[model samples]
Target: MRLDKFLKVSRIIKRRALAKEVADQGRILINDRVAKSSTDVRVNDKIEIKFGNKTLIVRVERLMDTTKRDDAELMYSIIEEKYERDFKNE
Candidate 1:
């Protein structure tokens, strides 16, 4: 599956266009490398998404053209989440 479509079908980014936009901005990585919207995704692939100061990493478990809301979570498994804290305000 395409990276953008996988993000949407897995209910990660909510929309395909947004996924593409994020990918274009170089905020999404596949296997530790920057990935484009058309990048191919397969099982066991690691996807990392950068959201401002927070980052989310997930591993693709399976692929499907369509899935129910309840089954979306089964598509990928959250591996790690990290947040960059600003200490200047402290």
Candidate 2:
């Protein structure tokens, strides 16, 4: 699945366009490397997203063309979440 599409389908970003914009701006990483909107996403891939003052890390657990709201959270597993305070310490 495409990174942007996966993010939207999984409800991680809510919209595909916004996800594409974020990826284009280099705000997302896959397996510790910068990822583009068209980047391929696969199971077990690590995805890190920088959202303003917060950072989120998740591992792709599954991929589906479409999923219900209740099933979206199952697509990825949260690995770590860092806030502004965490960044200040690093």
Candidate 3:
């Protein structure tokens, strides 16, 4: 799936446009490298999102076109330490 779509469908960024904008601004990374909105996301890939004062790191567990709110949570696993580290450094 596209990184922007995946983020929205997985309920990570809440909106596709926001995902695209953030990605275009180089605020999103895949496998630790800057990623664009069109970046392909696959299972097991690591994603990091930087937003002003916060950062989120998640391991892609699944790539779905659509999912229920509850099921969406299963799409990725939060890496709290990594997230916290990035946030702290921000």
Q: Of the candidates shown, which would achieve the greatest TM-score relative to the real structure?
A: 1
lDDT of 1 by residue, 1-90 (tens): 899999999999999999999999999999999999999999999999999899999999999999999999999999999999989888
**How do the candidates rank by lDDT, highest first?**
2, 1, 3
Q: What lDDT tens digits, residue by residue, belong to model 3 across residues 1-90?
A: 999999999999899999999999998889989999999999999998887757888999998889999999999999853323455547
Off by over 4 Å in 2: 86-90
The local distance difference test score of model 1 is 0.97
List ranges where model 3 is wrong by over 4 Å: 81-90
Model 1: residues >4 Å from true position, as ranges? Answer: none
TM-score of model 1 (CA atoms):
0.95
lDDT at 31, model 2: 100
Clashing pairs in 1: none
lDDT of 3: 0.90
All models, RMSD in angstroms: 0.8, 2.7, 3.5
Error of 2 at 24 (Å): 0.4
TM-score of each: 0.95, 0.93, 0.88
